[model samples]
Target: MAFTIPENLHPDLMPLAWLIGTWRGKGRGEYPNVPGFQFAQEVSFNHDGRAFLNYFSRSWIIDENDEIIRPAASEVGFWRVKENNVLEVLLAHNTGIAEGWVGVVKGAKIQLEMDQGYSSPSAKIVTAGSRLYGLVEGELFTSYDMAAQGQTLQAHLWSSLERQSEN
Candidate 1:
C-alpha cells in the first residue's frame, strides 16, 4: 500500500513522515529515586490525509536481559500541527491519563506542553508537563516532564532504535 501522505496538509509535517509506521524497540525508564524499569513498545503512527497522525502505543514488561515478559497497558493519542507552528496531541487510555498537549516541532525534535489529562474517570484535572523528541544519529531520543506523580521531571524513558519491520 502507498504510504505517501496527501498533498493538501501542511508541508512542514512531511519530515516526520519517516516515523509514520509501527516501531518496536526496547526502552529504559526511571522514577524519582528509583531504579529504571525496562520495557519494549510498539508505537504506531497513522494518517488519513488529515491534520493529525493517529498514534497508539502498547508496551511489554521485560526481563533483566530486556527480553519480553508479558503484555502491559497502552496509550492512544492524536498528534497534529496547530496554528503558528504549534504542535498538539491528545491521548487516552484505561490505565493512563486522557491527555491534551500543545507544542512545537523542530527538524527531528518536538517540544510539547501537557495542558490537561484525566486524573481519574471522576476526577478530571489539568497538568503541567513538557516533552522533547529528537532522532539522534539514528535512534529515537525523547524525554517527558510531567506533574502527574507529584510535580516532578524525570528521564522516564530512553531508547536507541533501528527501524525494523512492524509488529
Candidate 2:
C-alpha cells in the first residue's frame, strides 16, 4: 500500500499525521480481578485542518466465533504535539472517565502517561495509566498499562492494528 501524508493536515498536527487513518485488529485484555478475554477494535484519527487530531475508538468483546459478545470499551480524544516534542492527549470514556496524558513524540513513536484523570463515583477507579504507540513498517502497534481496582501498574491491553483506511 502506498502511504502518503495528507497534504491538508494542520502544521501543528504534522507530527501526528501518520496516525490519520482507521486501524482495526484483535487484542486481548487481562486483569488480575477478571477473566482474560479477547476483543476486536477500530480506532480512527482524523483532522479537520485543525491544530489537533480527533480520535475515536470502539471495541467489542468477542467470542470464539469472532462474533461480538458486547461492547467492551470506547473513548473519544484529541491529540496534539507541541514544541519540544511534547505530546498531549485528552480522552473521555463512555464509562465516565476523563483523562489527560502527556509525554514525548519521536518520529512515529509516542509514549504517554497519565498527567491527570478523573472518574465518576460509579466508574471504576483508574489511578494511573500509560500507553505506547508506534508505526513501524506500515503496522500500528500499541500497548496499554494501567493501575486500577487496587492493582499496581501492569499490562492491560495491546493490539497490532493495520491501517485499513486513510479517510
Candidate 3:
C-alpha cells in the first residue's frame, strides 16, 4: 500500500509518516501476579504541521469470544523525532503514571527505553521499561517489557495492528 505524507507535516517527522493513522487490533498481556488476559486496542497518531505527533491509545479487556468485558489501559502522549533519528516520547497513563522515553528509529522500527517516570501516591512504580514498534508485513507490531512491582524486566504485552481506512 502507498502512504502519502501529510502535506503540512514538519520535515523532522517525515520518517514517521507511515504511522500517521489509526490502527486497531487485539493483544494479550501478562505480568507476574496478574492474570493473563486478552484485550482489544485502538491507537492513533496525528500531526499538526509540527515536529511532534500526538498519540493516543485505549484498550479494553475481552473474553475468549472477543467480547468486551471492561475498559483496561489508556494513555496519551507525544512523539518527537530529532536529528539522527533520535526519538523522544512523553506519556501519561490513566493509572497515574507519567513517563519519558528515549530511543532511535531504525527505518520502520523504533526501540525505546524508559528514561524517567513518575507515579502518583497510589500507583505502582515502574522501575524500568522498554518498547519496540515496527512494521511487519504492513501491520504495526508492538511489544513491551516492564520491570515493576518487584519483578525484573520481562515481556508484558504484544499486539499486531492493521491500519484503519481513512474516513
Q: Which candidate leads in lDDT?
A: 3
The residue-by-residue lDDT of candidate 3 on 13-68, one tens digit each, is 98788888999999999999899999999999998888999999999999999999
The local lDDT score (0 to 100) that residue 112 gets in candidate 1 is 82
TM-score of each: 0.80, 0.96, 0.97
Tens-place lDDT per residue, model 2, 1-167, is 44567888888877787888899988888989789999999999998887888999999999988899999899999998899889999999999999999999898999999999999999999999999999968888889999998999999999888899896
In candidate 2, what residue range of length 10 has the lowest lDDT sum? Answer: 1-10
Clashing residue pair totals per candidate (backbone < 3 A)? 0, 0, 0
How many collisions between residues are there in candidate 3? 0
Candidate 1 C-alpha lDDT tens digits along 1-167: 12454455446557566567666677777766657688887778777766678888788889998778888758898888766668878988756468788888767788887777667755424356677777676655656655544645545566555545422
Worst 10 residues of 1 by lDDT: 1-10
Candidate 1 versus truth, CA RMSD in Å, comes to 3.6
RMSD score of candidate 2 (Å): 1.0
Which residue pairs of candidate 2 clash? Answer: none
Candidate 3: lDDT over CA atoms?
Answer: 0.94
The lDDT-based order of candidates, best leading, equals 3, 2, 1
Q: TM-score winner among the candidates?
A: 3
What's the distance in Å from true for residue 31, model 3?
Answer: 0.5
